[model samples]
Target: MKKFNLFKEIIITDRNVLTEAINSGKLFGIRVDGNICYEPFTLDDILIYRGTPDASLPIETIFGKNYQVLEDNDRVLIKAFSNWQEIIGFNSPRATYDDTTADGVDEFSTKEMENIGWHASEFNIKYRTLVDVLEDKCEGTLICIEQEEPYQFSGLGFIDDLADARDVLFEYCQREIQRLINEDEDYAQDNLNDDELEAAEFFKI
Candidate 1:
């Protein structure tokens, strides 16, 4: 089964407000030991984690020592994106496996299997379903919430919480583009040629 690490602080006093904020994506937050502590007032999931002002001690110290302040009536939510994506091979329209022939009259040959069917496989359906989450509008807002120090908005799992499947696909394309660039400098430079680079801006969408 697929799973995700969801760290949420439950607010006993103002439960409704916190829940609403999570749904609407308007909650303010601060980092407490790699976990995001969200405000129970707003409804925006800003994905921002403001650490303690004191630079001497680590953020963890504040949470460890002054945890009572946070635990008063609210709960902290710390969920990792690792459990968001799952590859379930279901309703697979096509199946491709290695077919090897022993060397006898002819030399042994192995075939490379790929998407060799017309219909979507079970795994494909699963993937598609996951992709859909990042494209279509969702009942609740999907956010990339993190409690660690702020970092660039680009990179793997950047769109892991997107509510639109189409947007997820676009994000995937972007990820692939970046991955290719990093993995193959020559290919990236070649692809980045003047005109091609200009036209490639569509991928940013």
Candidate 2:
């Protein structure tokens, strides 16, 4: 219910909006295309050397309209999710936001990533950031499909069979519906209990 100190996520349903956000300097570390460029993001790497594959690259360049990113939580961002164009999902401690309120800011940037514990990208720039993902030309895509849920993503993928994809996504939708029903039941139960308590207090029995 409450995402305290967590990176909020939203599912992107429109590519046009994604392009608009990225072009407006509203995103970074994007992995939309079929290539892998690491940062639209930053890193506090130990040593920027060949020994470490910690070099950064800009991403989200060659997104195919027919593709669909899959759900991935089994791997870390640097492993499966953070590729040139292929995408999975990510996990770790929560982290986002810009550096507007920080002590000072630079002209080209918000100095936002500096407030970092760890960072992630958003579908909307209006959402609070954990770190700056828009390091270069690349930026990740996120969108708000529902008001209650924020950060739940599978990955960036191409839609192979449109019909099949729809069916699969429908399953996801049904699952979400069940979750909503369960949540509503919980709230209703809680309210009923509260009413019962209030009635007991009034009766003084």
Candidate 3:
């Protein structure tokens, strides 16, 4: 049986924190559907399984602690499972880690951000280019952009040129991606699958 670690060592059993983690794109819950399911797990489904006797036994056995440690909070790191045997008792007959790789991480991040309502686009308008707009009015402006939906924009902003703006945006995107990845906790751990680890290592930011 393959070994998989789903989370970092920190044990988070708080319901509110778990919910916040899920909502803020920190922890991803696993959805069991026979053999195949999706990534960015569903919190409610995981919560349901966490309450079950069968799931509790395996979790306790694997973690060497009482199942109540989780407090019915379903949020966990992907690296939490040490092997397939540890997760076999889960609600799903087959628990697979298809999107735990670096590429998978990237795909998950992009889609997750979008699902949470982040809009990314090249600033374009009639006649004037994005560069023109930045150069004309945004130069020497201090601005802060919020990540959550109904984004609140504040301050004045400017860029040296279009290339600079593009780089800034790209850097911002990478930073957000890395931030999402870091939330997984196990992202930098040695316990990850070799392929997934390698993909993560090679992934830029």
Off by over 4 Å in 2: 1-156, 183-205
TM-score of each: 0.20, 0.18, 0.20
The 0-to-1 C-alpha lDDT of every candidate, in the order given, reads: 0.30, 0.26, 0.31
lDDT of 1 by residue, 1-205 (tens): 1111122332122334434434454433432123345444132222323222343433234323323223323543333233212100110111111111121111101121012111112112233333243324323222222344552111111222223434444455555555655677654646566543542454551
lDDT of 2 by residue, 1-205 (tens): 1121112332232444333434544323433222222332332211001111111312231223322233233321222222212221221111122122233122212232221111111111212221122211123222111133663322111222334433332333334334433566642324435443343233221
- Looking at model 2, residue 109 earns an lDDT score of 20
Candidate 1 runs further than 4 Å off: 1-163
Decoy 2 TM-score against native: 0.18
lDDT ranking of the models: 3, 1, 2
Our model 1 lands, by Cα RMSD against the true structure, at 18.1
**Strongest candidate by lDDT:** 3
Residue-by-residue lDDT tens digits, candidate 3, 1-205: 1111222222344445444433443323333221112343432232112311222243434334422234344444322333333333442222111222223211111233222112222111111122233334432322122234663322112222334444443455445446545665554444455554443443353
Tell me how far the alpha carbon of residue 30 in candidate 1 is from the true structure, in angstroms, after superposition: 51
